[model samples]
Structure formats: C-alpha cells, structure tokens
Target: MRKNLLANVLDTPSEPRTDYARRGASRSMRMSIDEMAENAKRMIDGEVIVSLDPSLIDASFVSDRLTDDEVEFAQLKAAIEAHGQATPILVRPIENGRYMVVFGHRRLRAARELGRPVKAVVRQLEEIAHILAQGQENTARANLSFIEKALFAQKLLAMGQSKATIKSALTLDDTLLSRMLSVVETIPPPVLEAIGAARTVGRDRWEELKKLLAHPAKAALAAEVIQSDVFLSKEGAERFTHLCAQVKSGRRAARKPAEPERWSGEGIQARFRKSGKTFSLSLSSADAGEFGAYLAAQLGQLYDAFKKEKAR
Candidate 1:
C-alpha cells in the first residue's frame, strides 16, 4: 500500500499558477503587487539563490516516470538543456531551511541529471494542505494515468469535494469519467496498490475484471493475467477483458455437451483443459518452438484419415 515517494508528481501543488505566470514568455506581462514583491524578494536574495532547504517542500516526492517513447523524451531533454528552465518549480519551506519540490519535475530531473542549477520560486504552506495541493494542481495539467487520476479524485473527495465537483475539477468527458469511476468501485485495496505501482491497467481492462469479482477465483485469475507480461504485451491489455467473457460463456455452456479433442500425441497436448464449453491448450516456450512442426504433422494425419474414410 506504500507509494514510491520518489515518483510523486508534487509534494505540494507542482505547477502553482504563480510558478508559471512569473516565468518564461509570460514574464513580460504586468503583474499584481504580490507578484512584484515576490520578484523583488528573489532578486534581493541574489539572482542565484541556493534554497535546497527541503523543509516545507517534499523532495522525497518523485516526478512521474518518463515515457519510454524515445522521440518525445529526446525532444523534452533537449529543450530543457537548451532553454534552461522556462517554468519555475514550485516549492515550500521546511523547518530547518529546506524546500520540497512541487512541480516542474521534468525540469528538476533534467537539471539534476545534467548538473544545472534549478530555478525555483519557493512558496510556503502547511504539510497536509501541501500534500493535498500537490495532487490537485498537477492533475489539472497532466494527463495522469487512470489510477493516478482516480486515486487523486478520491483524495479530493476525502477533502469534501462532491463527485460533481471532482468531475469538474478533473474535466473528464462524461462517458470517460463514468467508466473510470466503475473501475475504482470494483477494484479492492490490494489491486489498487498494484495499479498504483505502474501496472498497465485501467478502465478498459476493468470492465472484464469486474466480471471475475462475481466469482472471486476467476477474478484472481484475471488479476494474474494482468500481471503477466506475455498477455499484457501480445494481446494488448484487453486480453483479460476477452478472457473474462470467454470464462463466462464457457461456464454457462458447461451444463451442455461439447465436442471432444481426438485422442493423439499433439491433440492430447492441445486438449490440455476443457471445462464446460470453454477449453484451454497448454503451451510452453519450448512447445511453441516446435508448434508449427507439430501442427503440420497432426493436421496432415487428420486430413489423410478423412480422405481414406471418404474413399471407402
């Protein structure tokens, strides 16, 4: 149930409005007195202030993981290196002159990894509010994962926002929001933790997952499928969805008779498991290696048998 502290998007609101409005191309615009004052304070503190004080800020909180898509990552990394930080990271002061990172995580990571000094505007707030604000602000701008967004929405709900309010805050399309909400409803705590741990699961998969919960063991089976790399990648995540449907239809057909796999060496292997109308063929990497050979031999024999029977 523990979260990876290092993967947190913000220890406080990551992209606080001031954090963006005061920096980059927008810096040219006129500002209110508070903005002017903050700017003056920063200049006075020296152009390059070292406030690594992580007191009010949460450095332990991690930025979201970078996507594996190389092109986009390359573009982002290059842009940050060339332009320096176009957006000021949000931070809050801590007790012993420390600061926590709230937003601008991409910039922060780039700076840290590249040995560039990070530019930030240190803001301050209470710890609980800071934590709450952290999720609230970033979820607005970031395309958070289904679980991340839902869990964040739940957090807001705990903070006394109604579902309608949370919906508005998230700005999801109605159909999209409805589907996601159903997922949060069916998934239990342990599964939730798995979901939070970068597991590739969400609304689409949940429609199938929900079915299994009606029969707990099968639900557990579906969960195992989710945790499998082969199924996850090969068939796409919707594999579980289809598998669930198959299980349901198969279970219903159990009361009726069904065709049998003919007895033979490869056919025996193909008849690994059959329940009701649903059946399964067991396979292995080694077996898969020889599958084409096995299929050709077995199917050829069946064809030859049919030809002789017709001739007679």
Candidate 2:
C-alpha cells in the first residue's frame, strides 16, 4: 500500500533532476553529494514519508494560489478522511524546529481540518531550490490556471528573481513568460485579487481583458463593476466574465455617434462617418478606386503628420 501511494505521487514522468538534487542537498545532508542528491530526489519522489503536526508547519514565503476553493477543500477533506492522504507534502525545517511547506498546500489544509497529522517529506532546501520545487510540483500537476501561473510569475519577479529563473520555475518559454508578465502588469492587482483564481478563464480571454483595460474608459468600468454588489456576488470565472461584460457594455454605452457628411468633388463622391474612436470614409463614383488607392498609399505620411500635430 505504501508503495502504491508513493507510485501515485511519483508516477507522472518528469525530467531527471539529478543535478538539481545534488546541488540542493549538498549543504545539509552528511552523505556524499551524489548519494545525498539521489536521496533528496527519492524523498521528494515519495520514497520516504513521515507524519508532522500540521500546526507546526508554516506556509511558503510566496503563495501561488490566489484564493481557497472551499468546495474543493471540503471534498479533499472527505477523501482524506476516507482513504487517508495518498501523497505527502514537501517541507523544510525552519527556526524553532518548525517547518515551511514547499508545496501541497491544499493537502496540508485538508490535514489540518481533519485534525490529523499531515504526511510530509522534510528536506534541507535553500530559498531558490524551495521556490523551484514548489513551482515545478504545481506545474506538473497542471492544475493552476493561466492567470494563476501569471500571478505566480509576477510575484517571483517582484522578489527580484531573474526571468530565466522564473521561466525554469514555471516551465515557461521566453514568449510565454513575457505574455504572463505583461498580463499581470497590465491588470490591476485589486482587480485580479477580486476575480480570484478564475480557474476556467484561459489565456486568450485574459488577453482580451488586458486589451479592454488598456482603454481608460473600459478600465474605469471594470473598477466599478468589481466593486458593485452584483459583481461581488459572483465567484471564480464568473466574476471575470461579469466584469468583462460590464466593461464592454459600458464602452458601447459611452460611444458617441457623429452625423455622417457627404462630399462631391473632382468627379469623386465620398461619405465620412465617425463613432467614438472609429472613423470611416466611403468613396463612390468611377474615380473612387483611383482616389481610394491614393488615400491608402498616403496613409503612412498622413498618420505621421497627425502624430506630429497631436504632439504639438
């Protein structure tokens, strides 16, 4: 049974971490570097497990999850009550003989609620290794949403970690790491905290929100929606959807339509219309094609002149 449980935790195939294990374990363990690293990997891989007082354990310095899922926590507590904890959490010794969790926060929470000692593996990891281990474990689980990962990356950056370290920790490429940072930087922290984890919301939807919030008017609307009773009543992804809808609706309501005007000159007829920031020019007549081609060709110069004027 213990073997089966360990198999469940380590069953997911991951890249061999012999090098990382060696570096992380060399300081504290008395064994040879190679042996210590192997044992460290095995311990994290669930070869050894021990029960620790949940009350004696503290949270990691940085948090990856934005909010608690009460329903899921209840379900997890029930499962542990029935079959016992299948996997052990990872922790490192801190001052006063207390320990700090590296990952499996939900499991620890469940164990605490059940009034039972939590199953955990103790290791001696420096702060960098601790962050990497926590992030990689969650990444392997594939449970965190895009926004959650983005926020996690944001927090790591605020801690002065390098982009490469953040990428390695979260398993992100350069492009993805850039986008995640952009998302968190663009969206206000209060808005993100209010929306919670948004587990169902994905990258594209978040990008859309970022674009909308770029507009000052839409951003204001979002701020209002997040504060309102209706939006506050919603949860998780629903909050994100509600805020998006309110911002869009506010934009539509705020748009002002101008009267269309017609012009006929030099054997060409044209109509000009304006709505909010969008403007349109329609050309008609036999020479319209020639005139339109001319306009398209000069658009770059025209835009440059407009920018100069706006700057003035």
Candidate 3:
C-alpha cells in the first residue's frame, strides 16, 4: 500500500546571532539568493506528494486550460475510478486553510465529483513559479491544442507576466511565442471561445483566418455563424473549418465592390469610391466644381503635402 505523505516546509533564512561573530553575518545573507533558487526548483520538482480531501482544495483562480467536454470528462472519471488517480496534482496552500491548484484541474474535478481524496503535491510557490510549472507540465503532457496554448499565452500576458517569463513557462522560443500571441490577440476572444479548441487546426490556418476576418463586415457574420445550429453540430476542428470557409466565401462575394457613394451639401456634390489600392473622387455642381478645378491645378503641391503628412 502507498503510505500517506506529509509536507516538509523548506528552511527560511534566520537572523545572524551576535555570539557567532561578525564574520559569518554576511554569509547567511549571501546564501539567501541561492536558497530561494533552490526552493523554487524544489517546488517545480514536486518534492512532496500528499493526499487531501477534494473539498479542501480550491480550483485555480484562472484556469490555464479550457473547460473539458462532458464526453472527455466522463472518460477521465471512469479511468480514475478503475485505476485510481495515477498522477498527483500540484497545489499551493492559500487563505482560510484551503489550497489552490497549480495544475491538473481535470483530475481535481474528477476527484471532487467522485467524493474521493485527491493526491497532490503541496508546494510554496511564487505566482510566476506556479504558472511556469503549470504551463510546462501541460506542454509535456501534450494535451493542450495549439489554440489552447495560444490562449494560455494570452492569459499569461493579461495577468501581467513578462514576455520572458511567459516564454520560459511555455518552453517556447521567441518566434513561436510571438506567433501564438499574434494569433490570440488578432482573433476576438468570444469567437474563439464559441468555436472551442480546434485540435486539428494549426498556427498557419489561424493566421489565414485572422487575415480573412479583417473585412469590416466579416466580424458580424462570424459571430452569427458560431451561434447558428449548423456550427454547433460539428466537432471543434470542423467548426473552425466551417467558419473559415463561410467567411472566405463571403469575402469573395464582396470582391466586386459597390459603386461610389454620392454626397451633396450646399449645392456641391461629390462621389467617392475605392478600388484595390486606388481611390477616386468626382466633383460636380456650380460652385464646388470650379473650386475642384483650382484644387486640381495645385496637384503637385497637394501631393507633396500628402507625402509629408504620411511621413509624419
């Protein structure tokens, strides 16, 4: 039988005693930094595994993972019921004699629902260290999809974690981290949530979707697609594909572009239209037309000013 485990708190620095002499006083202070580093390493290593009643541990305040689907949760619960929880979650003690989870939220939920004790490793962790362990563990497990990881990166940034810290926590290089952040930041959060995690979708597809969504009217259409019954019927990856296809088709339909909008004020009239990279404006009516001619004659000066304004 596995024995019940107990937590051992790491030692903290103590005040230097005068009887020991002044020579050793600075030695303890110098060890402080090294000691802190060691403690953090121990926290990540999960040095102690203890069992706690599920009710005593609170879920992480900001979960790093998306909500598990009912079918997935049921499968996990069944496996744990049969084999017992094979993995121990990591947690930190919090106020009111409770603990906050650092990772393994799905296991925690299963244990809670089953009314069983959850095996966990209790560690004293700074917030950054906790998140770093949490992210790295998930990455190693290979359970999070690409977009899920992107959203996690976005959440870490929102919580004010430095870019360096986030890169370290996710075990990503600068370029990959930049791509993840860009994808998450470009896609609207609600739309992402609605589509769920696109397990089969990768970074490049999402980038393409972002570019397609830049159309001024595509946002409202994308929002409607997620809410439609058709969208909900499909699996996560399918849902993402469906929305992208619809939006891209919508862009094609808009390619013809509409005629110029006409405006009239004070007996002066103008027509404005944009085609590809070019814009055209046609002026008419008695007063404004002649003013338009005079303005046209100064095109050289106007073009110079426009170029200077763009530089500024």
Alpha-carbon shift of residue 204 in model 1 (angstroms): 6.1
Cα lDDT tens digits for candidate 2, 129-190: 99899999998983898999999999999999988888999999999999988888988888
Residue-level error in angstroms, candidate 2, position 60: 0.6
For model 3, the stretches where C-alpha displacement exceeds 4 angstroms are 1-46, 251-312
Supply candidate 1's per-residue lDDT for 207. 62
For all candidates, what are the clash counts? 18, 0, 0
Instruction: Write model 3 residue lDDT over 1-312, tens digit each, in one string.
Output: 123222222244556568555557567766887888877787677666678998988877666666577788899999999999999998998989899998888899999999999999998888988888888998888478888888888888998989998888788999999998888777788888987877778888988888877666887778777777677778888999889988877632223356898998887888999887998898888777678889899999999999999999
Give the range of the ten consecutive residues with the poorest summed lDDT in model 3. 1-10
TM-score of 2: 0.66
Which residue segments of model 2 deviate by more than 4 Å? 1-47, 251-312
**Per-prediction TM-score:** 0.48, 0.66, 0.65
Q: For candidate 1, lDDT tens digit of each residue in 1-312?
A: 146565564454665467566685365654565678876887665333443422234452433322333455567678878875676666766666667776656556667767667777665556444554555666765556666666656665566656665666566666766676666667665555533423365566666666556577655654554455544453323554445564565433122334555444643333455776876565544466488577667987888999999999
Residue 170 of model 2: what lDDT? 94
Q: Is candidate 1 or candidate 2 better by TM-score?
A: 2
Model 1, 59: alpha-carbon shift in Å? 3.7
Q: RMSD in angstroms, all models? A: 17.9, 22.3, 19.5
What would the C-alpha RMSD of candidate 2 be, to one decimal place? 22.3
